[model samples]
Target: MAIVLRYVDSLDFVKERFIGIVHVKDTSSLTLRNAINEVLTSNKLSFSQIRGQGYDGASNMRGEFNGLKALILQENDTAFYVHCFAHQLQLVVVAVVKKYDGVSDFFEQISLVVNVVCASCKRKDLLREQARERVQKGLCSGDLETGRGLNQVTTLVRAGETRWGSHFNTLISLMKLFVDVLVVLDFVKEEGGSLANRQQASGILAYFKSYEFVFYLHTMYDILHLTGTLSKQLQRKDLDILEAASMVRGTMEALQSFRNIGFAIILPKICNLQNIGIDLVKQAPQLLEYMAALSPCDSFAQFDKSKLLKLGKLYKYDFDDSDMIDLEGQLGIFYHSCIKDERFTSLKGISDLSRLMVSTGKHRDRKCRKMFSKLKLLKTDLRNKIGDEFLNDALLCNVETEALTKVEDEKVMERFEKMYAQRGQI
Candidate 1:
């Protein structure tokens, strides 16, 4: 059973607000949907009463074809589904670290040793003692989560919405304690621990020593924050649609800065088990910025979906167009206009199957088949399914001019110039 929390607005209450945790069963099996139907049938709360819905980053809960959000939207167009920002940010960092071989190896090594040390009854005790010693030595004071040092490897990778900067501190602190952990492992080995234990410890130590691990720890912050920005927007309160649209616009603007970094190195490598060049690091930041910016383009759907899929591949998050039940037409218009510019069309091979085949398949001649097959597997379109109204919006575009008489315009311009001159900041 899964519990889904929904924010309900109360029109009759004094405070005009209510939040409820609807206990749902095996959401994967449609238990929650059945339950919701039963409740709505019995109570006065119709589909019209629902204002917002939130779920963890579970595929069954957010998937487009059959997830909880899909089922809800099918019933009521007003029930807006907001992806949990905290979860999105978590997935972002994991995607980036998974790219570099060195970083992946380092984390795998850390998890291997951390699991070994904390798995056994005796070893778990040793970890507690280590925690106590660290506390006594003033390195830490609270009951330390030794299990998470291994178990939360993925969680630690991403930043938080409210506490985005904590990810940086988590990495730094982990590195500082890494040596002390090895010392404890050595103590266990000399005390006649199993040979398997010694092997895991040595392997972990060697992995961390590599340059790749160190580089990953250093660069993780950029990717984590970049993702956190998305999470914050996705989870933003639904106070107004205009505000949400503006936030989406800001996110898109920020992501544009990341487009220069080649997709092959940063996004594709993270999404799949592909080898990436370390030199790609030089351009990843700007490229990541560009990737983030693309999120808000309503006509964004018209752009290459294969590219977006590759970008989203690393994480377990989904942004269903249908979920934007209210903004469908607007989104279509945004994406259609976005791709018409000479700049978007000029970007080379962005839609070329031959180039896509290079990364995922062996035969370039059969690239179209491979590309289509891959697209089908993900249940997505290669090109965004944008409508024609986006083109109409583009054609109808005109700067809305506020007409003023020449004398009025001069007076307004003169006052603006006087203010600007006083500032002397330009």
Candidate 2:
């Protein structure tokens, strides 16, 4: 059990410090709480000093009645609990991949292939040699580019059960060394050290060379790569909650867009590879609809009115019930009223900082004044440099002039006749 603490330094920067890990006999709430208390006591800290706690969404840790969080809160009610974002992302990827039996089978076979190929030093050397030959041949034919970081030799990377990004790297490495892997698998099947080994290798090689496996390999590579990028961004220490919420929403939209049109984009490439027909495209697995609806809602509660409206539109598909729609309508009205209030808009820049300081309630010192003065100077400089013309241009750059207004939506269908006519040309 790794323990860490997050705190704000004198400079007003948030920092995480590593606390000593504790080994407990069991994961019960009492045991976990005792372990934590031991760590705190050894470090000369008190339970009352804890402002927040973050852990994975485990029953023993996050349970409402008898979890570590509850036990800690009993002592110090101010220690709020937050679920770890990185762990949540890993769970999301795991759930999405396991939604399809074929995807689960693909990962299982890939793991077996990695274990078989890298079981011995001789096989490892053979793989490296084969990969080197392939790179040389491709370079000579002008099919591969030569650069500092391009076309470097790659080794098999085994995917971990916990690390979501590892699967993306493993799939990418497999695709890069596809021919070498096939050659090694063929060798193992034809002449193995034992009969049982040869049989296993033969079965795996057959599955590895199949067109279905290839389809999933490419499909998951695209999907996992995007999620992996978002996961990395969320894991950054300096990431703000607002930015993380925006990234989560953007990723969901990208996934939804891919679900709607990715088959068309990937089909041509797959067909060119193995002369497959359109039937394969029709048989391709669709992304789960619920996956596109997943977003970090807790962080989004801090969003401004404009951002909230954009979020509502993005998640409008999930609000299938009247109750949800009504709730969202009320939320929109609340944010709209807040936006109309001049004081709220004026104080928006420092609201986040103010909230943070209020939570700690430690800004009654000189350090707080220094931080405030720096922010004031920054605001003054930004106001002086950014003119009305610049603001107007920034807002107008991406505005769609052809968009229909509220009046058109309320009127008859004929109001869009001209717009539909213009759209037909493209």
TM per candidate: 0.43, 0.62
Name model 1 segments beyond 4 Å from true.
Answer: 1-29, 49-52, 78-80, 96-100, 117-172, 189-192, 221-426
lDDT per residue for candidate 2 within 119-215, as digits (tens), equals 8888888899999998899999999999899977778999999987999999988888888988888888888899987987899878976887878
Candidate 2 stretches greater than 4 Å from native: 9-12, 22-27, 38-49, 76-78, 268-426
- The backbone clash count of each candidate, in order, is 20, 0
Q: Cα lDDT of model 1 overall?
A: 0.47
Winner by TM-score: 2
Model 1: per-residue lDDT, tens digit, 189-280? Answer: 66636787677667666666765565455445444445455555655443223234445455544444433343333443343223232222
Candidate 1 residue 153 C-alpha distance from true site, Å: 21
